[model samples]
Target: MTRALSHGDPLEGLPSRARIAELILSSRPPLDTYVGWQHYRTHCGLLVPAPTISPRQWSMLPESRQYDYDLYRELTNANLPLQDTPMHDKVGKLIRRRLSSNTRKKDDPTRAGVMISGWGNYGKTASVCSAGAVFEEQWLALHRCLNPAALPGARDLHAPVVYVSTPVTATPKSLCASILGFFRAPTRKSATLPELVRLVADSLHDHGVKALILDDISRLRMHRADDQDVLDLMRAFMSLDVTLILTGVNIPGIGLLREAMWNKTTRQWELPPLESTRIHGLEITQTEHRFDLIEIDRFRYVTPKQIGVFVDHLTGIEQHLRLLNAKVGMLTGGTMPEYLMRRTGGVIGLLGRLLEDGAHEAIGGKELIDESLLDEIVLRRDGPEQAPDEPVIPTDPPSAAKPPQQTKSTRPRNTTFDDHGPASATGR
Candidate 1:
């Protein structure tokens, strides 16, 4: 009898090329339903780091082997491990604490949520999703990987996390529909707003969802009636005993917090007076008061400590690189770090893209990275305009050695006088 291949089984030979290709295709998680979320959680937890091969060994490999190796390297480079940064640490700690506290309070009418606010590419969504994944892992372990509320014979999925991005033009009905869609729940076009809300709430309870992440939340503008309704819908979700996480670019600057004032003493945002009849009956204050807002900013390279931290981050990226001719201190060394800082403006997303593109170029050509190679690459900025404060690299500090003496021009002097004398003789 032949044994069935397990996920851990090694892929090798000509046949392994097809296998690796399949794995690459399936690497991206659907991330909409419970099953999809499970796939993502498992993928995140079970990433197998690609093996490194020396240049000499690579050169000796057969053509087929070289193709397989290159394919695998491409896969690994695209999904390099998430590095530990100050922002990640801060967000992770806050999320863990909030989830723990929410889980303990079984009778609280409303659970506090967390808002991860920052410029795009500052890793707001990544940080929140990672934290959610970690929380789900621990939650499952505590429950022994079984849904405590699930029936013995039911086919319900035990999803501890539900992630959904707000629609580009979000409405209350649409937002609720988005959540229900994650659970693959049936939704009739004729269903009322209240019906959709109930469906979403019931689905969350039925699936044992502990955390709900609403990404790109700033898409909802407060000025619009539909968006206002969407905000109210979010408030309703808070009461369903789930830790709601909202992530967006410049959340405060966006209209999400319009007319909301910050109270330093309470360390919470206070909603405006309930003068508008539209929100008079709804609980508008709880969301602002309960949700803890956290900001993630790009790396700063001004101070000595700041420079050290930035270099440390680059070192982390260097360690994960699989380039054949990559050298020590390739990214973190002397002027190279400054060059990268200028190129990316210390935005982690831009930095990662620049490095990833450079790596591909390196693999195809010299198998090494340098300032000149990176200079040829350009990155697209999709986020809000970079702030003025985070300007281009500062002028270099003055050197102690005297500057080289200026040299006199070697060209002939201006020819206006010489031409004028010749012109006069010709005119006469």
Candidate 2:
């Protein structure tokens, strides 16, 4: 007789064929597969730190197990913890205030936007993305994990933050398409500029998008007609009640601020005479008045306070390292801190890259970070053309100071007397 499955049955927990098929069909793609709703949602979720293995335990493992552990450590090194630098704190505060204020002003015709400008490799994208992720997390929790605007019995993804990179060759239509792509909203190939804009606006509303982030804003040259239209299109998005955040490298140097002058008294950017500029029939006044421009620069190492803060940042990174031979103050103690500062030019992104490469090299053999190991790792920023704004090497910090090398004396008098004996011996 056939027996019924019991709670203790080995096969009882196995999924049926139908359940397996459903999972295969419904499972979300990995974040690397696409930069859409699924990816952004996953990114906003919690990230568990990699498992920690003590040096003693690692030493006890078999050869194969050691190889696996090393592989995992390499991956972990690549993604070091995101430190809460001064830039991140400022950006987070500004974004949080702007998003919270915007939510209360639902009936306002337009919302003021934020623009983050800085040098390349200065962590502009990371700062903005982290702030956006935090905002999305709080927004979802506030809405009870449901889209407030969704219709009853309808399934709609709640995307509080929409991030899209400005295309290298952006136009009004192409920019709209980029925004729509984030939501995975369908758009016909033959769709006109106006149609695409309407679709993007609808998607923003339908998905309950609270903030829209457009990175690489410097790519839009105001000198180009297409870029001008794109700028106007962004202004139009501001009217849709979503806070528009634009980040880029050297935004002020770009023509974006050409028509706007900085007012010292008001401490804000203001537009010139309205008659001075008009783009695509839209006054530049709207953009100047509606967008608050802020900057996030690379770390400075001049002042005592600055030096202390820089060392503190290194301390934070050192805490997250999983190296078997990592010791306290590996990065912050001795001459290493000054060495890293000079190597990275106090740029957070470059510092992270340098440490990442150094960690990989350490894991491969030494299992510890030191100046000798870091010297072997080359960085892209080391090029002459891409040299940092500050001097690469500093004269302070006695430990980092290098003594001049001794060279052989060029005077022939000393050699003349010393070689006479050798010449006489040879002649004899």
Best by lDDT: 1
Off by over 4 Å in 2: 1-56, 259-284, 382-428
In candidate 2, the residue pairs with backbone N, CA or C atoms under 3 Å apart (3 or more residues apart, or in different chains) clash, namely none
> What is the clash count for each candidate, in the order shown?
0, 0
Provide the global lDDT of candidate 1 against the true structure. 0.78
Report the lDDT tens digits of candidate 1 across residue range 1-428: 01223433223333377877887776465665666777777777455545665676667678888888888777767766787888888999999999999988977899999999877678887788888889999999999988887867876888889999898989888888888888778899999988888888888887898899999998977778998888888887889989899998657656565445445466454556555537567545556687888878678888888888899998887877777777789888879988887778788888999999988888868777889899889887663445423532223335699879999989988877564334565677
Q: Considering only N, C-alpha and C atoms within 3 Å, which residue pairs clash in candidate 1?
A: none
> What lDDT score belongs to each candidate, Candidate 1 first?
0.78, 0.75
- Candidate 2, run of 10 with poorest lDDT: 1-10
Query: Candidate 2, residues 10-87: lDDT per residue as tens digits?
Result: 232334445434533554542221255446555543333334555666666677566655655565577677788887
Best by TM-score: 1
| TM-score per candidate | 0.80, 0.76
Q: After superposition, how far is residue 109 of candidate 1 from its true place, in Å?
A: 0.8
**Candidate 2: global Cα-lDDT?**
0.75
